[model samples]
Target: MTQFAAEMIGTFFIILLGNGVVANVVLNGTKGNNGGWIVITTGWALAVFVGVVIAAPFSGAHLNPAVTLALAMAQKFSWAKVPLFILAQFTGAMLGAVAVWLVYKDHFLKTPDKGLKSAAFFTSPAIRNNSSNFFSEVLGTFVLIFVIFYFTNAEMGNDKTPIGLGSLGAIPVAFLVWAIGLSLGGTTGYAINPARDLGPRIMHALLPINGKGSSEWNYSWIPVAGPLVGSALAALLYLWLRI
Candidate 1:
């Protein structure tokens, strides 16, 4: 597949399973309604694994706007490719959210709680404070991108390495994601990926669901802006630290 196709396919699974977990937890009549933090984290980790497995060969399977932007800024990836990746990711994320909606259509109709319905499709902070929520997103994305660079350098291995190494590298990355979610995800659901947070959010607003609440418009920018800034900061820090 082409790079664009790979990115879109990768991103599709990321949002599908990532937001799928939220739907499981927050929507009515789902088994995971109260599964809480652990479930969401694990689901996302596995989702990343699935996406990477599918798209790694073609596009390196970024599936993340923050990752694409950071690698571009660091000159690790071609700047020209950045826009394509972001567009693919956003479109894929929207498709994924549509899938989640289909999977839970019955539950959405049965559920009367607007907050719960929204949570099923997207993210919102448990608390309403903007500063704390924004900071948490930034910090979370910082750690995510910084660790990604470390792992890429340490374990991605040379091209001479077997394809299986890519699969193996995913484990540590997945675990790191799990760790971040367990620690910092309480606020704003640790939306450390711009595409992951915003794409599905747009879908929630556009998709028909009963009793969905205000889109939390004021807070929406935090995840997208925070992760981009945080990833850049982390990239710079990694360069300094490596030196």
Candidate 2:
């Protein structure tokens, strides 16, 4: 696969499995329904592994736009390719979310909790404090990107692509995500990626599901803005450390 197509396919499975787990846990009457937080977190970690392993050979599996931006800022990725990668990630996320919706259509109709339906699509704050929520996302992404910077002895691939934990294999990164989800995800569900949250949330708005309720556009900016800010900070800090 080409780089763009690899990115799209990578992110497609990322959201497909990630959101599929949420739907399994929260939507009504599924076999995995009510599986609780550990199941959700574990599933997302595995989802990351699946996406990375598939896309790493071609696109380096950035999957998250924040990761792409951080690599660009760190001079590990070309600015020219940033937009293309991000577009693929967003498109993949949307398509994956649509798949989730279609698979869970019956459960969605049976489930009356609008919040639960929304939870399957995007993250929301447990406490709803804007500043706190933003900080939560930023902090979670900081851990993700910062630790990623030190994942292996090398940082960038030969052609200036961001080679993430892929160089070291997918297991370490999977554990990293599992750690983030278990430790820091409680507050804002640890979106840590602009495309991951925004694209699916957009689908939630457009999809014709019964009792799907509010898209929560008012708080949508936090996941995007916070992850960007955190990734930038991680890049800058990593650069300074190198100096």
Candidate 3:
């Protein structure tokens, strides 16, 4: 239960801050309106840092269900706990999206572009290329989870808790996310966490956000399926390398 709450809280902040940046940048009249990609990515990176720091002690900060699934596949985490962790992450993400919606309710009203409003809650492909978009997510998450496997290894997090990266500190994991965002995120906004994208997306569908656009359900499966596939691949490689 402690672990569950930890992940839930961590994911809540993840969406609140991560999506909050999008709302600020894209929504009309916000101070951060038109802040650009760097601002959004940077905000998400910092959000991860803070959230990981908060959840590390109790849950190892597997705020993303993809990470949880990958860890279990690599034999670092137990299968029994995967469902619980994923549920917590999704619940937390939904609550966080709700917070973002409420916080930016006025902004949503001020902003007339429904696409911008939807962007604040979910990821969409810049080009709408099915193969390329799915590939982008797969490649991005492979880097994320593969590198994550190395973070808590023999030397980096040495003498720290061996469970996960934050055992060393949250900064490295944060920096890892920052690097991924800066490098590979251009393709699909790097929806590396299924819960992060899907949970908020579901909220967008259910919420009464005056003019929120299509949830893009047709492309929805990419973010979820791609991350899971990529994480699984990362786990397989981790095992193959015996690292």
Candidate 4:
């Protein structure tokens, strides 16, 4: 398959599994309805694993716009490829959100809490404030991408790494995601990746679902903008500190 196809498929599963867990946790009632933070973090880590495994050989399985941009800034990835990768990632994320809606349609109708419904599709804060929420997102992505840069440099030189983690990297990354969520996600739901939050959010607005409220456009920019800034900074810092 071509790079676009690989990227689309990779990003599809990333958001599908990532947002799927949120839906399972926050929807009216289900097995994972009350699964809590641990579930969400583990699901996201597994989602990354799945997408990376599938797209690693063909396209490196970015599945994240911030990641694409940060790598481009580092000169490891071509600027020309960044747009196509982001497009594919967004498309895949939208498809994933649609799947989540279909699977949770009945529960969505059952849930009267608009926040819960929105939480399943995107993110909302336990405590909503502009500066704090935005800073949290930036810090989260900075840490996440900093670690990513470390791993990429450690394993794959300056460019993006191939995704086959051989079941070894899985536990560690999952644990790290778990730590991030357990420690930091409470305030703002840890939307450290732009695509992870925004794509599903767009779908939340577009999809015909019950109890869906305003897309929370007011706070939407934080996740996207903060992560980009954070990831870019992290990449630069990593280059200076580690390289």
TM-score of each model, in listed order: 0.92, 0.97, 0.95, 0.90
lDDT of 2 by residue, 218-238 (tens): 999999999999999999999
Give a tens-digit lDDT track for model 3, residues 1-243: 388999999999999999999999999999999999999989999999888987888888889988888888887777898999999999999999999999999999999998999999999988889999999999889988888775456123222343454554688878888889899999899999999999999999999999787999999999999999999998898888874
lDDT of each: 0.80, 0.92, 0.88, 0.78
User: What lDDT score goes with residue 7 in model 2?
Assistant: 93
Listed per model in order, the count of residue pairs whose N, CA or C atoms clash below 3 Å is 0, 0, 0, 0
Q: Name the regions of candidate 4 deviating beyond 4 angstroms.
A: 151-172
Top candidate when judged by lDDT against the true structure = 2
Q: Which candidate would rank higher by TM-score, 1 or 3?
A: 3
- CA shift at 135, candidate 3, in angstroms? 0.6
Q: Is candidate 1 or candidate 2 better by lDDT?
A: 2
The best candidate in terms of TM-score: 2
Candidate 4 local accuracy as lDDT?
0.78
TM-score of candidate 2 to 2 decimals: 0.97
Better model by lDDT, 1 or 4? Answer: 1
Clashing pairs in 1: none
Clashing pairs in 3: none
